[model samples]
Target: MLGLHKKWCLGICVVVYGQLLINALLTTNKTWNELDWLDILGEGGTALLILLWLYFILAARPGGRVTNLMGAGLLAFFVGVFQDALDEIFHMGASTPWHSVVESVASPLGMILMTVGLYFWRQEQGVVNRQLKKREKLFRQHQLVDTVTQITELNYFKYHLRIALSAKHVKRKFTLLLLDINQFNRVNQRFGNAEGDRILHAISELIMLNLRDDDLLSRYAGDRYAILLANTIEAEANVIGQELIAAIEHFAFKTLQGERVRLAASVGLACAREDSVDSILMRAKQALALAKQQTNSSALGQLVAV
Candidate 1:
């Protein structure tokens, strides 16, 4: 992730270098007896810790306005703290008032930027939380999260499926959509497993983006996604399934090596009936198999004609 934000990293490096140059040019080294070891230890250590935190933050998040703002704020704070540490070993003559300038200006500027960044971060989380409402249905289990897609696992989906079946509501039956990515294992064989995992994650996010606010999504089997459309009927869910298939058809996933990988999705659509979880799943699976067969035959026809 840090490698992805080269411009931000480069800008911080420049600021640090400029500060070092200014300090060296304007300030003279203090006498050995004049150096305050205690101040150096405290201020210097703090600056070091902040620098590490900046690195971790950059590594964790993608490049965006919020990330940029936070990185810039941390860098500004680093400059001020680092300059304070320098003050203990360097003589800040009357002509060189940078010590006062850095302490008074940089620290406050950093704080202000950080505060603004946090405000935007909160708004971002609100959107994410709304999306997750359909995912958990007021339930949470950290262990059920999938390693590849970071979505909930099959067991979690099954848990919710059983509940939806037993509960009596105006809309007694919910639509279940199972999507299997075509030739997923082939992707792992051609590219590395790491690249395949990235594709899985990408496809999962794409599906989530196309779903309604009240739909639950989870990882099922190796490369299949199970979606519970709580508020959607079979006809509406069928349209959504076709939309998902079309979306995947048009998606051009660029690999780390610059190769473009176009993906296809086969969706199985079924509506819930009674408390029969196994039957519902079996119907969906059968539908998915039929869809896959059609896709293969179509591809084969195209190749023969070409």
Candidate 2:
């Protein structure tokens, strides 16, 4: 969509430039200062737009040889635009050495910067290609599954759960932790949806940092998150719960008004026996309800058994 829009805009620019050239030729006054502010603004604006379009294409497109070639084309486009914009804004008469020097240097500098950007872009694409190959096996496995979205959700749960259950089934011990942001709706109501989104992203990053690579983390619902721990009993889960509570307690988030505001989370944990995933999740939710029910709770955090 962006590419198409850019092409249409470039076409309009060509038409306007053609009309301006014809007018310049037909009129008696052909001097440089005869150019109006409207012409300079229109031509300069078009040049800037072309440069912007080139930058977006190189920066945002997926990595590949085709993208590399497109990036090179963008470099050429930038050179053309730089020269055109300089011509519109400056009078490069035969006597003005500085004006000629500016005109000569602008195009080459644009080309050099664009070329450097493309080189790094190509290297970045190589890294992306390797990562894509690693994910290909998982992608194929996903195609065999009925629900791809569900499998993605289950990736952080079932994958870890299988390892945990296999290692500790004989002992019949494990725990599930559920964490929810308190008064999250109030943030959206008071500030705006954009502010709410930033809070959610920040909280998610914080939770992810606290977990082991082997642990499971999932965004279970809006303002709610779940974690499944391996070989962890109710007491151990409670200890982890306290650590999480401390982490959030120490966090100070900045509001839209540039004021510092503190936020808290309510957590619930449940120990697992010979239980299925659904059962464990249900018990964890119940524990979370109990935590939220506590009175005079500076911060709500609790642990319970299934």
Between which residue pairs do clashes occur in model 2?
A: none
| Model 2 residue 11 CA deviation in Å | 21
lDDT of each: 0.82, 0.61
Candidate 2, residues 146-221: lDDT per residue as tens digits? 1211212444455555556556447757778888777778878877778777777777667666765445555667
Model 2, TM vs. native: 0.49
lDDT of 1 by residue, 236-268 (tens): 787888888888889899899999987777888
Stretches of model 2 off by over 4 angstroms after superposition: 1-173, 295-306
Worst 10 residues of 1 by lDDT: 297-306
* Poorest lDDT segment (10 consecutive residues) of candidate 2: 143-152
lDDT of 2: 0.61
Off by over 4 Å in 1: 1-128, 300-306
Q: Please, what is the TM-score per model?
A: 0.57, 0.49
